[model samples]
Every structure is written in C-alpha cells, then in structure tokens.
Target: MFPRTLLCLAVFSASTPLLADTVWLKNGDKLSGTITVFDGGKLLIQTKYAGAVAIDWKEVKTLDSDQHLLVKQDAYAGEVSKSLTAADDGKVTLANGEAPKTVELASIQQILKPKPIVTDLVWKGNVDLALDYQRAEKDTDDYDVAFKTSARHGRWRHTGEGEYNREVQDAETTTNNWRAEYSLDRFLTDQWFWQGRINYKRDHIEELARQRVVGTGPGYQFWDDELGAFSLGSLLNRTDYEYRDGSKDNFYSVAMKWDYNRYLIGKKVEFFTNGEVGKPLSGVADYALDAELGLRYKVTDWASLNLKAERDIISGTNDADLNKTRYTAGFGVAW
Candidate 1:
C-alpha cells in the first residue's frame, strides 16, 4: 500500500508542469505559472508560491502553454497561432495546425488570453466610494461614488463613467448632483478612432438644474500597454441647459478631452487623471471644465486606498456662474 501511494504522488508531481504555463530563462531558471499579460516589455505571471510576478520579456529564452492566447507581433498583420510551443533560444513555435511556424521572440509585441466569443478582447474597470460624517456642532455628512469601465473587442470599444455626490449639514441638504457619460469608438486604424458620446448632468439644489450634451469627434490613442494608457480627443458638441427659474440656454461648443493612467512600483500604485475643457461657440457660457485626478495604492490583490480631487466649473450661465472643488480619500476594490 505504501509503495502504491508513493507512485501516485510521483505521478502528480511529474505532471504539474504539463498543466501550467512555463517560462524558460536564459540563466537556466524555469518558472511555472499562469501568464496574465505581456505588454510594455513586461510579462506578468500569476504564481501560487509567490504573488503576481513581472518579468522583463527580453530575458525570457522561450515560453510554452496549452491555453489559447492572442499574440500580436510588431508591424505584423498575420493571424496568430492558437498556442505556443517552446523552441530554440530566442525563438518560439506557434502551434497553428499541421503546419507549425517559428518566429523570433523579439518580434512579439503583446500576449494575452483570448476570450471565448471575442478572440481579442481587453476589458478593465474600477469603482470607488467615499463617505464622511461629523458629530460636531454643525453636524455634517457627505457621500460620493464614482465608477468607470471600458471594454475593447476586435475593432470596437465601449467606455462609460458616472458619479454621484451629496452633502448634508444640520439636517439640510447642501449638495445633490449626479452625472453620467458614455462613448463608443470604432477603430479606423491601430491608433486612430472616431467617437460619439452623450452626457447628462442633474443638480437638485443648484440654480443650473440640468444639462445635456451630445458630441462626436476624433481621438488618438498614444499608448495602451501593461504599464499604462493615455488618450486625447477633440469634440464638437451641442449643449442645452435648464435653470431652476424656468430659464433655458442652448449653444454649440468645442472641447478637448484627455484620459491618462500609469502604473508604478511594479503596478502596486496607480496614477490617473481624466477631464474635459470646452469653449462655447455661441457664448451661452464662456468656458466649462470638469475633471478629476487621483492616486490609488493597492493593499491587496483587489483592495486599494485612493485619494482624489475633483473640479467642476461653468462660467457665464444665464442664471448663475458655478465653480466647485472637492477632495476625498477612501478604500475600494479593483479587478
């Protein structure tokens, strides 16, 4: 009986590497893990012994895996193989069919898992919330929640964001507002795309009670890789505003929008900023701006602490000019 048990244990131990993704280093080190992503010259692997590990792609001698992966080659438009097979140094065999192909390792640009329906889908997003209360003479309470998400499959991408804020002091509501926006992008080429977006804002206590905007324009993606992403857009918009005193204003505007984020310290810390600035063509308002900037420190794989500052401004409204700034710190979860 003891001899049979020993045989079973040996079989399991010998078969472990066959089921995992393996990376062979030039220095004769072998790593058994699941490949998470490879971008910005860093290949990330999730290992059981250690946490997620980032390895410089240049140092890898070769890699092998049985799972379907999407591998993009720099300046190459050919269809990628379904899986990878280890080859000689500085090369890998792409397992396509009866006819496998070999390619130089330096030509590989990105590596990621393929989705079931969409072979090339990259999705990422986050949600954050903050709350505050005071028991002093003035008794105050504040709540804020914001979220942004994006998904890209093939040539199409969808992005959306929303935020809500409220504050109360001595049983009186001082602020109540919420806003949402959505945009769609169809990639015309690798880095250029067209976008159409719609936005709505509502404030219960402010004189500028409601706002609506629809815009379309061109955008450029600077870089989107393992380290971070940045994009800038220019839009032409038609906007309408409603005031608490039953007044209304309409105008045409042109705006510039920016979205940017970066990972630091091996992706344990993140810095992100996004916002829009616009000038009204018809002078319904001279200029308007809405923006936020923040930093997040990851405490665990999915939990984080964040600090953020937000600014909103709308000058030259018919009934009132508005300017507001807010700061918050809180904990949240991220994927």
Candidate 2:
C-alpha cells in the first residue's frame, strides 16, 4: 500500500505544471502562472493551462513570487527589486534585504522582470522599404527605403536614422536624394539628457544639392516603456547649404525636435511621428521643417504594414525656396 501511494503521488506531481508565481483574485479565484509583465493597468501572466492571459490590475487581490521582479511604486521614481511575499488582502511584503516592508498592491504602478545587470545592453530598431513602378503613358519608377535604430547601455543611448529616395520618369531621373542623421545622448536624470547630433542630406536633382547640420541641445524623455515613448529637444544648430550652382551658405539656427510613438489595441497597432522645425538666427532661411508621420499595423511579432507621409520645406532661402511632400506604403520587418 505504501508503494502504491508513492507511485500515485509521483504521477500527480508530474501532471501539474511547476509555476513559481501565483495570484489570488478579488473574487476568491487563484491562478498559478509566470508573471510576464504588468503595465498600463494590466497584469499579464503565462500559464500552462491557459497560455498567456491579461487581467485587470484592480482584480488582483494578493500575489507572491519567488522570481526577482522590478516593482515600481506609485509616487516613487526608482524601481525596487525584491521578492513578493503574500500578505493581507490587497497587500504584499517586499523582501527588501534586511527589512521586509509590506505595501498595498494598489500602490504598485508597474512590474517587470529585472535585468541581470544594470549595464546590460538593450537594443531595438526597424527598417522599411517602399517601391513603385509604372508602364503606362510615362514610364516611371520610384523607390523609398528608410531605417531607424537605437541602442542603450548604462547611462548612454545611441540613435541613427537614414533614408534614400529616387524616382525616374521617361528614362530621366526626376528626384534623387538621401539623408542620414546620428545622435548621442547622455542621461543626466531619468527624464533629462544632453544630446549632440549631426545630419547630412544630398540631392542629385534639386538646386540645393547638399546640406549639413551639427547641433547640441538638451532633451526630455517623457516616458519609455513596453508600450511607447516620447521625447522633445531644443537644439542650437549650425547649418550649411551648398547649391547646385556651387554657392554655399551657412548659418546658426534654433530648432525644436520631437519623437513620439504609442502602441494601441493590445500593441497590435502603432502610431508614430517625429519632426524638427527651425528658424535661422541670421535669416539664412525664414524657417525649415523636416517631418514624418506614420502608422504601422503589426501583422505578426516581427512583420508589419506601414504607411507614412513625409514633408520637407525650406522657405525663403537666399538661393532657392523648397517644398516637397511624399507618401509611401510598404511592408517591413521589425525587431
């Protein structure tokens, strides 16, 4: 009888999934799973029986976990890494080394898996391409390719973006231009940073054949999380322009730049916009704007369809005034 009991116990243990985390719901239901993340008022968990599920944060009554998690509390700027010990209803104890502290679960704003080390690198980026061709009244070919990437480690962040565009009509190149920009940022605080950037643009058909800019400024990071991020910067720039006729002009300018993106509908769709507007300090040009806005519908984890509109304007330049806008649609991969 003892041997039979041991065999039954072993079989039961083998059939049950091993879950290190558990949450007790307000309605008296309990669930065993691995916490994926808690963000935007939703707690996501992965369970063997039900796959991944999202529960309203308000529905969580108590929780315990053996994993190291980063818990951000309300009214607190920094994150805490500690074990979660179940306490009273709607509360948990943080095993904060020597002193264990209990806090209301409602006061927790965000929960995530803690990185192994502070200095570990985090990287994310995407590339997109659009192409068009026609064989009607006038043979035409168009191509647009753009890419943006960023990487961060410790207190430093690096960002870069570039685009190439070309169009041909009747076997003649009508539009050809390419631009690239790179920026480096050093964080002074969680939401504040200093940035230095350089940009270059070249056009094969336009009167303004070459453009170069260098800038330095301070930027504010509103927020960066699993869902989205936004940032704004003010820059003092020195811009140089060279025309197709070989005339060159340079001037200093002040500019405001913004980058924003948000994920919606369970992160299946994304809306983004980034742009810069500048006024020359010396009247080199009345104003200049370079901007793009886009929407991406994620088809899969790493694949998406994108539509974008871009605008470039240089009003009242000494040699030539410029205004151009373009629209594109394409499919791309992301990571």
- How do the residues 1-335 of candidate 1 rate in per-residue lDDT, one tens digit apiece? 99999999999899875588999999999999898988768889899998788888999999998777788784223355778899999998999989988989899877878677766677888889899998898999999999899998666899999999999999999999999999999888878989999999999999999999999999999988778899999999999999999889989999999999999997899999999999999867889999999999999988889999999999987688889999998888886
- The local distance difference test score of model 1 is 0.89
TM-score of 2: 0.77
- Model 1 stretches astray by more than 4 angstroms: 1-18, 25-30, 74-82
Clashes of each: 0, 0
C-alpha lDDT of all candidate models, in order: 0.89, 0.88
Residue 12 deviation, candidate 2, in Å? 10
Candidate 2 C-alpha lDDT tens digits along 135-171: 9999999999999999865568999999999999999
Error of 1 at 129 (Å): 0.7
Give the TM-score of each candidate: 0.90, 0.77
Off by over 4 Å in 2: 1-120
| Candidate 2: residue 328 Cα off by (Å) | 0.4
- lDDT for 163 in candidate 1 is 91
lDDT of 1 at 178: 98
